[model samples]
Structures are given as structure tokens and as C-alpha cells.
Target: MLCGGTSAARPATDETQQIADKVKPQIEEKEGKTFDVFNAVEFKTQVVAGTNYFIKVHVGNDEYVHLRVFQSLPHENKPLSLHSYQSSKTKHDQLTFF
Candidate 1:
């Protein structure tokens, strides 16, 4: 892929779930609602100075949310942070950079 461009969307893996779990609380707090079913289903990634994870999460029923979680360069010793999110989405929605 072109440098600094987003990668193609792909099925979420264990690592993806782990990343999503780390940022779930932040998302829930902002939305003012907790998600009982927080499962990462699909994702895309953009490599910046660090990496930005664009994830499609299944939050039970027909509800989905797109999350942008940023991970700083390992040596920086920074924790993953929830950069942004889009709620009230569906399973069919494309997981893209936001």
C-alpha cells in the first residue's frame, strides 16, 4: 500500500479484539451507554508516526460502532487511546478511516 495510506479492510483477529477491548470503556463513557456485546468484526489500519486502528465492532443486535484507536510507537511507552468513534451503525457498514 502507499506510505501512510490505510490498509484494506480485513476480518478482525484476536489482536484486533484486544485493541478494541482497551478502548471500549472510553467509547462507552463518551456514548454514556455500555455495550454488552463488544466484538471486533472487521478492521482497517493506517500507519502514521504510530498506527491508527479503524475497527467495526458488533455491539449486539443490529448495532455496530466504528472506532479509531491510536497506538503510539512502542518506545514512547504510551497507552492506546480512543481517538474517535461513530455509533449507531450496522453490520453491513464499511469499516474505513475516520
Candidate 2:
């Protein structure tokens, strides 16, 4: 058998766009609820296959949050990852990531 380890590649932008297209209805159709980038409280994302990334926005003063939303298993409740946290003196508003 010969070795052929080259894997196929797809554009990341396209994948992200596809996911957004699927979830647009939920974002816009929430009953009387508007997503203000400055006041983002929480977010939800779904993944059928491959990577689906939605951003976590915050509409606060310090702009302490600039994170991307993750696709989690519907049953599992996972906390936000704080791996890239910085040692700043500003207090950041708390927001839940789903």
C-alpha cells in the first residue's frame, strides 16, 4: 500500500457563513428580543457536522469580551474557557456562553 496522507481542505469563511445562514432565523425571530452587540448576555450554537462558529458579543464599557461562540452538545453544560484571560484591572461584565 502506498502512503497518501494529504487531507482535503475547505475554506473556513464558507463554513462559518453556512452555519450563520442556518441560525439566522433564531437570531432574528426571537420574540421582541434584539441582539445588541454591546449588551450580549448569552448565546447558543448548533453543529450538525464540521465546525460551526458564532461569535460571543458584549456591549459593555471596557469591551472585556471578544470571544467566539462554540458548538456544544445540547445536553452537556460546559463553562466558558478562561485560558486566554488577562491580568487587567478593569472589571468585566459577566456573560454566559452556551
Candidate 3:
């Protein structure tokens, strides 16, 4: 990937799921509802001062959501935050920058 450019989308790994899990509560609070199935299905990353994760999540059944999560640099010791999200999605939807 080019410097500061987002990487190509990748299939979600256990580590990716952990990253998604870290920001799940923030997402739930923002949406004012809880998800029964918050599973990371795919992801892309962009390196900034720290890193940005663009993830596709399976909320439950045919429902899905895309999340933009930010993780601060290790030394900063900040918690991951839900930078943005798109709800009411489906499994067929492509995971893109949003």
C-alpha cells in the first residue's frame, strides 16, 4: 500500500475480531441498542499517526454493519473508539471505506 493509503480489504482474523470487539460497546452506545452477533467478517487498515480499521461486521442473520475504528499508538495508551459506522447492512454488501 502507498504511504498513508488504506490497505486492500482482507478476510477477518482473530486479531481483527479483537479489534472489533474493543470498539463494540462504543458502537452499541451510539446506536442505542445491543447487537446479538457482532462478528468481524472483513477489514482494511490505514496507517495514520496510529491506525484506522474499516471493518465489516455480521450483527446477526442477514444483518451487518460497517465500522470505522481507531486505535491510538501504543505509547499513547488510548482506548479504541468507534470513529464511524453504517448500520442496516447485509452480508452481500461490500466492505468499503465509509
Candidate 4:
């Protein structure tokens, strides 16, 4: 039973790495033009109705870009939905989605 449980967990880790690998370049390309340094700081996963993964990237020293993957139906081959935004110090009247 323990061995089965360990085997089951491997795929989830691999999937998360795959998602990160795919998304990192896109974010780097976009943010690279603006920030001098771009690096991934952390990755967080949330499983609610579906699996959601968040990648936290640091742009320069202060600014940050958040990359989110929303999988409405987990384990589907269809492209996972992606949402990303750069953090701002100034307050905005309205929220923006990208």
C-alpha cells in the first residue's frame, strides 16, 4: 500500500514541473524586455474543484509577476488556461485580467 501511494504521487510532481517548464519561458520573454533580472521565486499548487498552479517570479528587486494555471478539469490533454499579471505599487480602480 505504501509503495502504491508513493508511485501515485510521482505523476503530480512531474506534471507540475512540466507546466512550469512550459510557462517559464513565455514569462521570461515578456518580462525580460522590461526588467534587468527575471527569476522564478516559488511555485504553489492549489487543488479545489480543479488543480490550480501559481508560479511566483521576481522581476528586478521589487516588482513581481504572478503566473497562474487554471485546469478546470484535471488531467485533460487540452491546453491549461493561463493567467498572468505584474504587480504594481500603485493602486488601481479596476482589476485587470490577462
For model 3, residues 1-98, the per-residue Cα lDDT tens digits are 99988899999999999999988889899999998889999999999999999999999889999999999999999988889999998888887776
Model 2, 1-98: lDDT tens per residue? 11222122222354444443444335435423443433323332334332223333333455433234345455666533222211111334332222
TM-score of each: 0.97, 0.27, 0.93, 0.45
Top of the candidates by TM-score: 1
Compose the digit string of candidate 1's lDDT tens values, residues 1-98. Answer: 78999999999999999999999899989999888999999999999999999999999999999999999999999999999999989988888777
Off by over 4 Å in 1: none
Q: Enumerate clash totals for all models, in the order shown.
A: 0, 2, 0, 0
Full ranking by lDDT: 1, 3, 4, 2
Task: Tell me the spans in candidate 2 whose CA falls farther than 4 Å from its real position.
Answer: 1-12, 31-52, 56-98
lDDT of each: 0.94, 0.34, 0.91, 0.52
lDDT tens per residue, model 4, 1-98: 23212111211345565675566666667656645554555555566556666655555656666667666664565666665655542221122223
Q: Which candidate is the best by lDDT?
A: 1
> Between 2 and 4, whose TM-score is larger?
4
How close is each model in CA RMSD to the real structure?
0.6, 12.0, 1.0, 9.4
Evaluate model 1: give its lDDT.
0.94
- Candidate 3 lDDT for residue 93: 86
Root-mean-square deviation of Cα positions for candidate 1 versus the true structure, in angstroms: 0.6
| Ordering by TM-score | 1, 3, 4, 2
